[model samples]
Target: MSDVVYTTTHRVVVPFYVYAGLAFLVATGMLFTGAAEFSGHYFQPHILAITHTMALGWGTMIILGASHQLLPVLMEGELYSVKLAYLSYTFTGIGIALLVWAFYIFHMGWPAKCGALLINAGVIAFFVNVVMSIVKSKKENIQAIFMLTAAGWLAFTTLAGGLLICNFTENILPDGSLHYLSLHAHIGIVGWFLLLVMGVGSRLIPMFLISKYDSPKILWSIYGLINGGLITFIFIFLREAVSVLYMIPVLCVTGGIVLFGFFCRKAYRQRIRRQVDEEMKISLLAVVMMVLPLVFLIAVIVTLMTISADVHMVLAYGFTIFFGWLTAIILGMTFKTLPFIIWNRVYHARAGTGATPVPKELFSSRLFNIMAVCFIIGFISFVAGIVISNGIAMKVGALLLLLCAFLYNANVFKLLFHKDRML
Candidate 1:
């Protein structure tokens, strides 16, 4: 059998990585500079700008690029159109740029709407390409099915986001603009980003470790629970149909988590190689990190029951979910995924032919361990600062996070720069 050849359909993916790296810089800068607390501005534009930059420009951009590369492998078919991938990237990049500018300049009119429209188009284009490709493929894999389902959620995410932009610019809704904004953000997070990443992880993590554990049952369970929760959430929260309907989403989300935990346990048990790599270890920790938010989430619900939710509590909630859960998973995955991508593109062709060394010899695991510790320290401290309302702690935590970011980046760079030397 021939070795799998990984080739990105669009070159835009590499630029997205560089852009994402810069986004980390800006986000860290805001943290150290205390820009989260603007002078006399509760709604800090600087914070908003940085937050959106990381979410849209960095996280989503990389996901789109990776999806384009993986769709063919998962579906057992060539991508329907590489040109469409390029088109989507261009539109998405333009949209992200405009949105960032609009945030900085507070231009909530045509610029915001246009940006939203562009992003929507990009998402639609991506969905069309992937869905059509899957339909034509010979193999019907569970991972591909999960991906298609995730694409449907992506459509809902973009639709909600587009309406949110309209709400930001004008009054076109019944309840209020903030209501829709909340709806849109959660849908994107829970439905699009979290759901899709988990779907992919269920496949890649086991395969990378050469495990034969099949997770189709768990995948289907998670799929039903998440979408069911989201549907119930929209009907109850957005339409204001029933106050008690909030419980449906909360319960379904919990069910999804339970199913995922089972899948992880099964994979760990079934790994052919008993001794896992550093990336797997870090990813395991990330799986544990998912529970942190559920704790805070339950607290938030209780607090809302007793009294009106405080703004600081809301801030803490956001910080915990975005930084604690999402950042941890991304940081862990980056170390593993980036190395593989680099190995495939730069080193794979030369390996086993006396032309290159193994990819594992390129990096220092000790360095990665140190970086992981610092990151965890920083992340915990940052969340604590928000809860305690300590600006100094937040600043220090941000600095630590910045250090972790640089270290991780350096580790990856070392592999790229020293590939030939190791050989």
Candidate 2:
């Protein structure tokens, strides 16, 4: 790796963080307003709106931006085209704003349909750009393969979502819309989010730790288990199969999680750097959070097998995956990666000529610590409220989460406006 590996300009990445910040702010507001009733049902209009805001607006948008910058470094090549990156971002940003607005109003009209189409188009643009970049790159590694595969899953997920939106407007699905929602959710969650995190984390974690740990075999196994499990899931889900067969996908996903845990442990044990930063600590905590879903999934499977599928357990599982694990990782990694990009832009020219603040100085660690504590407390209280059906606890949790979001935005602005020579 080089001192600076980002080939994409700051213009490409900065707007994404801006969009993500706005999305997080909006999501926090939704949670605060609907806190008392958010856990009541997963399919409510408000819930759907908030979920898409988090998933597409906050999560997918940031990933797309970061991937454009990181993929070149991972593949040891330059980006194929910056214009396509801008187009992808524009389409995705506009599409998500429209889609979330439509969902918030519980309207399945032309606006929502058009939003879905725009989102699908944006995803297509992204997929084409990434695939072409990989093809022209000199490096052909497992990390690139993981990214390419995740891009495929993203395309499929978007297409499925677009079709679902169309079905809402035109009643195109032979079955109910709810049946396909699960498929769409899983494809986005497991196939796209989980796989991308694992793929990217595998490369970045060890690199950050300054450890010379490499395990191609373990990574290969992790890949096989996840893809195999997802394929089996798609088949069963599409066929509408019943029985214990659904457990197979759950087990495969769990197996991947377990293997990843081991992989992280190996990386930690072999790490040369003794002191890990707060950002990395939060990211490592996310790795631990990944196991919570497995536990919830077990409960979900058990309920399905014995009595009935419990909506509460299902909600818990989804919540753990998205908010607990995925959100934590993204929040943590944003600080870890974003500072470097900003640093390169601000201090690259001043290197050796004068004293330039390091990337770590771009933001306050104390603020990050506060945000982390609030996040964990808020997440736990919210989940507990859901489990116990307590509205007060949920409200408290939402308020705390809102505070965390505020702190997050504050720190982000601090970094964005950081001066080379701080007083």
Best by TM-score: 2
Best candidate, lDDT-wise?
2
TM-score to native of every candidate shown? 0.90, 0.97
Q: lDDT by residue for model 2 over 268-349, one digit each (tens)? A: 8899999998888889999999988888878887888888878888878877876789889987998988898888878888
Q: Write one digit per residue (lDDT tens) for candidate 1, span 1-423.
A: 335553563354555555566666666666667634722223556666666776777677767777877787787668888778888888888887787777767788888788888988888888999889888877778777777777778788777777866877576777555666557767877787778777888887787677898867779899889888888888777577544456678889888987887888888898899988877777777777777766766666666666755556666656666666666666677666666666666765566777665556667788888888888898888878777777777877888888877876778667556544443
Off by over 4 Å in 2: 1-6, 352-354
State the displacement of the C-alpha of residue 175, model 2, in Å, after optimal TM-score superposition: 0.7
Which pairs in model 1 have colliding backbones?
A: none
Prediction-by-prediction clash tally: 0, 0
